[model samples]
Target: MPDAVMPREAAAALKGDAALPQKCLDCGQRIGWVELFFSLFLGLFKLTIGIISNSHALIASSLYSAQDFFSSIIVIISMKYQKRPPTEDYPYGFGKIEYVAAGALCLAVFLGAITLLIAATRVIFAGVTHPAHWVAFWAALVAFGANVMLYRYSECAGHRLGSPAILTTSEHVKGDAVSSILVAVAVLGTKAGIHHLDPLIAILEVAHIIFMLYHMLKQSVGGLMDAALPEEEQEQIRTLVTAVDGVEQITDLKTRAYGQSNEICVEIELDPSLALAATAPIRNAVKDTLLKGLVKPSTVKIYLAPAGEGRALASSRQQAVREALARYYLGHVKRHHLEITPSSVALRLTFYSQVLPGMRKQICAAVGTNIENNIEDGTVSVSEV
Candidate 1:
């Protein structure tokens, strides 16, 4: 029997710390809380300063901050639910909740962008009474600094935890940081006597938000739909599975993304002569290979099929017959060939025994009976060489 040994790294990643460790969950919660606090503080500060100074750009940035605050809450909730183990009612666990949270975040950002766009348009129609107050510029600068810090922290935390929600939130923070810079520039331009620059910058920020919304929405919807992994990754999985020693052919391979990880299902054909006990190690080998390779699926299901099942070709059936004969003959048989037809199979065998008066005929009859009993309808011819 082949050893069903799994690589240490593969074992750890598939069954150990890489699969949502409690420490990582705790870190995700802390990061979410930190983001929520900063988003709330900055949203209120920017909104207040934007209103006091009539800075449209700052108001738009405030709306983005508000969205970030909402997204932070959703992230925390997703992390809480995602920690639950698979149960009878939900066999796949709550990993998909992260995608739902992401979709909601995209919707919230879309609505905020539309609202900011309308408000900026209205402000553009109405003339500016005066230049934006210098205080609003300071607020924008502060928001920029805060968002930059949050982006750095959340990005690092996302990578460490391997949480898609955290990573998406980090991208949002990065966008907010860029928007803040634009807001600051608009405020300075307004103070420098460019009357329309503030509202124009607000419209520009709306455009950027919409752009980000497209990508976030695509990813969230893809996850919800159980989209397949990229073709390159699928091909890589095929290559690894085919490299296993006993795998004859891959009949089926499937993959889909689930939260931060992926799920894979593969069906492979093995030699018909292999005992049921022998297939266990082959399955384990395939699983270990995938986990050790770049695929690293969180869930792997392998189905084994014997050669010559269903639509298997004539050559496969011939090979199965040969294997069976080899087992039955032990070391006595020298050479053998098989011909399979729609209704019957014919096998020719050459043995290492000396010819005697009717020994060849008796040997042929015995082998024919054995082949017919073991395999399908078949005739065997034996000769001494």
Candidate 2:
């Protein structure tokens, strides 16, 4: 897919306390209502015709449609709640409710599939009376066409809005479409005197339902667990942040999926002497770059840290000690003793100095302060030889 670049104006529009755009929310809700209506209608129509025509496949397909009806209800409820503004008690908003709804939908589907499986198995052992009526074939065909339209519409809307609930509902509609077609074929086979074809097709429909349930379950569980974004997307974010002008180093980057969007936390190093005012532009640039380059909706937070000495100097306590000596202009034909520990670094310098005793003590104090600042948790002592 082409990279999704949200416009600067649109990103800015969401900066304040506003929720998502009303237009998008309206569209999602409209789609959910439409799905709910069609599923209910199809479920009733198929169930009624399946019984009249004595077709096990049509009955099983009707159960799938019934599951879709309930799933649509959950999707609608989740879409409503997920749009609510964040509160102090739940700072992240209710976006994860979509995943919760998806999990519930999976459970409904699992139960329906199991029920269909048992009924079909019993029918297979019981003997068929006669071929299914031709009216059931026509009903399945009509359900198939309706679901095809719903699937396309829902899939398009889901991608546009980045709504997980809508996307998962679309998958359900797509499966319904496929199973309806299979039901239609089985009905025709029964008319051709293949009595077992009906129950066999019902069993196949159950298998398909279970397969789809597995995928939806996995996606919902990942969302609930706050899984990280895909590796490629994380790399893309890193590349964008590194290209900003003032970022000296990236110390850490964290990304996690929050509902349909991603949340990113990045820590970057800047010049130690750079003014705080100078970092604003760099921060804005990184945020804009990520919003434009990433495929999904995203929120970014950046932390600024002062750049320290290079890795070689940071690792070697001796280098830190030498820097302290140079900074203090300490004159010495000096021998120094160094001690390093996990908690602190200590350096004792014995040197020749012409300075008075009072000045020498002051120099020692200054050197100790310098070492603490540079080595970050350290002490130093200086004495005349």
Candidate 3:
């Protein structure tokens, strides 16, 4: 009963972007390795400087770098999850977990910001602050440069992959770039006689981080909750589906996003006179049309029903019943006989080759359900001949 999620925004983004040739499932692997080493370098460099100078600002920057370090690890883990093929146990594939990863990254950013805010506040009110050493200045500069490079790399790759985890964490990494810039300013400002500038910049960066995290959560939570495709895209899909030959009208359409693509269920109404064989190809055409430029992998289901105003031609009893059977199976015919009696009906289905015993019960149950729906009162029997 759960709804489906579609990554619509990324699909839209992909429209104007023609340069990124590598948005495959394995996109984050290289990004992870890149961020991993850089974050480790940045975190260690800043932590060392912070320890030597006893500066909370540098120490907190070190923690921010450490957060990036962990995010890279999470990215690698989530990438593995993203690459998992759909199995019998997981028919929908493992793409939705990327949104979960994005959520986790968002939470980490929020917690880091809050922690930074609390620490900065204490330092602001705790009277005179210890002066940061010259080594702290070089550390801030190095962190700033490294963060800028990481931000650019993450942003481009995330957009290409349509991955919220990559995008959100990249933005978080961008915040670190901003943080280091402010840290550099704070150090220089304190040296230039504005002693309060250090903590003030920290406060500003905290506010910015909170604002960014709020937006990331707002966007990501919807996807995690099986958000639908946007109205415009829905209309676009509607137009495409109905344009296919033999689709008289579209009665209903539903979409759910899983990873980068959409899972769609379309209800198509056709003239009742249309043969089941005719409907099958129409369904396939509609699927191909909708998926041509779609960004994500999709599973599409087509439901066919008679058009509301269409009427069937009158036929003899035997012909009508056989026609119904043919329509249900889309004219994939074998030797079949329908036996009717008051309060009971039986169908003998003769297959051309071996009938798998496992499928025999399923076929019978399906035909039984169909009979119950149509005739209203017969217990149907299914026998494979």
Best TM-score among the predictions, by candidate number: 2
Error of 2 at 237 (Å): 1.7
* Worst ten in a row by lDDT for model 1: 1-10
lDDT of 1 at 287: 81
Positional deviation of 156 in candidate 1, in angstroms? 1.4
Q: Per-residue lDDT for 183-291 in model 1, tens only? A: 8898889878898999999999888778877887798899899999889989988999999999999988878887756788887888766644566788889987877
Which of candidates 1 and 3 is the stronger one according to lDDT?
Answer: 1
lDDT per residue as tens, model 3, 279-363: 5577678777766655554666776655653322211223435644664454333567553333345567765445566665566
Clashes of each: 0, 0, 6
Off by over 4 Å in 1: 1-23, 294-297, 307-385
Task: Report the lDDT of model 2 for residue 3.
Answer: 17
Estimate the TM-score of every prediction.
0.73, 0.74, 0.71
- The collision pairs in model 3 are 4-256, 4-257, 5-256, 5-257, 6-257, 261-296
Model 2 lowest lDDT segment of ten: 1-10
Q: In model 1, what lDDT does residue 332 have?
A: 56
- Two-way lDDT contest, 2 vs 3, winner: 2
- Residue ranges of candidate 2 with Cα displaced over 4 Å: 1-23, 308-385
TM-score-based ranking, best first? 2, 1, 3
